[model samples]
Target: MLQTDSMWRCVCALVLTFPAYSTAVSGVLNSPTNVQLTSTNMDLVLKWDPPAGAPRDLVYTTELILRKPLMDSKPGCVNTSALQCDLTHLVVSIYGRYTGRVKAQLGAQSSAWASSDDFLLDKQTSIGPPNVSLYSNGAKLEVSITDPVFVHSSLREIYYYATYNITYWKKDRMKELKHISGLQQNRVVLHSLDPSTEYCVQVQIIASTAQKPSTPSIVHCARTPSEKEPPWVAVVVALFILAGVLTLVVFVVRHWRSLSHFLCPKYAIPEHFKESLLAPPKSSLYLVMQTSQPVEEFSDQISVVMCSRTEEDGSKKPAEEKR
Candidate 1:
């Protein structure tokens, strides 16, 4: 019975000592190790490794402490089983200094917090692509870019400044790439392009040396206007046409008389008919008068015969002829 009593006292003492030992063990848990901070275009992520001898089912919680010019904010991740936490939805300042820390928890016990080195938000975050606009100049293409405006409440700057990497190519000839880099201005002019040709352009944002460039903007397509004909060319063509028309008019005027005669001739008697009808009658009369009688007797006979013929035809002779 005495041995049993001693065993009971010893058991109670051991039980009391066990609680203190457990408490001490829980307090000495090693902190998480190798904490890291990384970022995407829109969000920040915190990652850490569990300490040695950490339980397989150990859960992690994280917190972000931000220090800005005039403000301080604390955003936390609670009761998460993941080794990494995404603090994207937090309303932390974009232009602020940030530090992320993580702690591992197993049931009621928790490890010490592992903190990351101080980092600037903009230094770790990438800028988004800029908006692009295209215009059709006569023989050139005009490209205008609008830089991204950060809308975080903590960001007081009006605009985010960035350099641009502009890439353009002809739609039909995509193998040939044209690039313009380190351009600080928002607008650029592309020259020596074929008139009325299809072209495509894209732009990317380069914010700082630490941050990588953002994704390229959506491709913009535009066609340059067609070329205009020169005034001198039109004038020369008009002069040639006018000269040709005038030459044709002068040729027609010079040949008009010959053309008319060929088309229509006047009606008249032939020279051969006049000679055959009049010459024979005159020759026969002359021969008859010479062979028949003397000139005076022939003339008197011709007059008496003409008078007899005139009376027989019911015509009267003049008084001078009768005498």
Candidate 2:
């Protein structure tokens, strides 16, 4: 019975060992999928999606393949946990064609490398958009555009020359657009614009090495300044006003007495008129006596007569008479 128990235990051990060995020999990992290469402002990047059923702890490795005679892949992003890698520094030739590849790794097991589509460095790389600033000069508008930022190379270093494309229009008149293409100046002046009017503008770069023109900058708006009067005109007007004030002051100094006399008088009243107004009123006795009837006058002279007694009939009787 003890011999039979030992054989059964050996059989159970064999079964467990066989399954583990089979998994080790036959199991295969899935490679990374959907690899892509892209660049913006000369900054190249490699991106990929994790393999199906990939573990959360799986690491990744990346390589850059340059298409040429006897060329080999350059290894980077080795044993990395991130899904993306920056290969901006690995680009040796600005005009060369390139490709990117990546693989998923977990301990001793690793998937095959998945490749990306071919990328042309000179024609496929993207450039940054332009930046715009506006200023309102008197009777004109000034637009200023700046060069796009570069990652590993400058505009002059790659293309040797660059230009700008400007589009402008009156405010609220978007359909009537005006374009100024292939401008070489950063500070562009728009002349012959309407005065005291608002205008909107956008700018783009014409890079020779870029696949197309750089993205257009944000729209900027400003109003043209109004026309101003000349400085000499104001001076002339002020001089005229000062001259008139001086003339008026001189005239007043010369005719001050005449003006005062016309405005006020100093005549005096007679003394008789004052007495007549202030005297007390008299009675009307003289006026009534003078208004009586006139009496008759005698022509011959008469002698005086002395009498001691008068007649009784109201008649005078003379006692002695003298002629």
* Prediction-by-prediction clash tally: 0, 0
Give the 10-residue window scoring lowest on summed lDDT in candidate 2.
19-28
Query: Residues 24-78, candidate 2, lDDT per residue (tens digit)?
Result: 5766468899999998877779999998778899999999988743355788789
Q: Which stretches of candidate 2 lie over 4 Å from their true place?
A: 1-25, 68-70, 227-323
| Total residue pair clashes for candidate 1 | 0
* Clashing residue pairs in candidate 1 (N, C-alpha, C atoms within 3 angstroms): none
RMSD of 2: 32.2
For model 1, state the Cα shift of residue 123 in Å: 2.4
Lowest-lDDT window of 10 residues in candidate 1?
151-160
Q: Model 1, 46-155: lDDT tens per residue?
A: 88887886768878888887755645556578878778888766645666778888887777778777899877776666566689999988899999998665545311
**lDDT of candidate 2 vs native?**
0.85
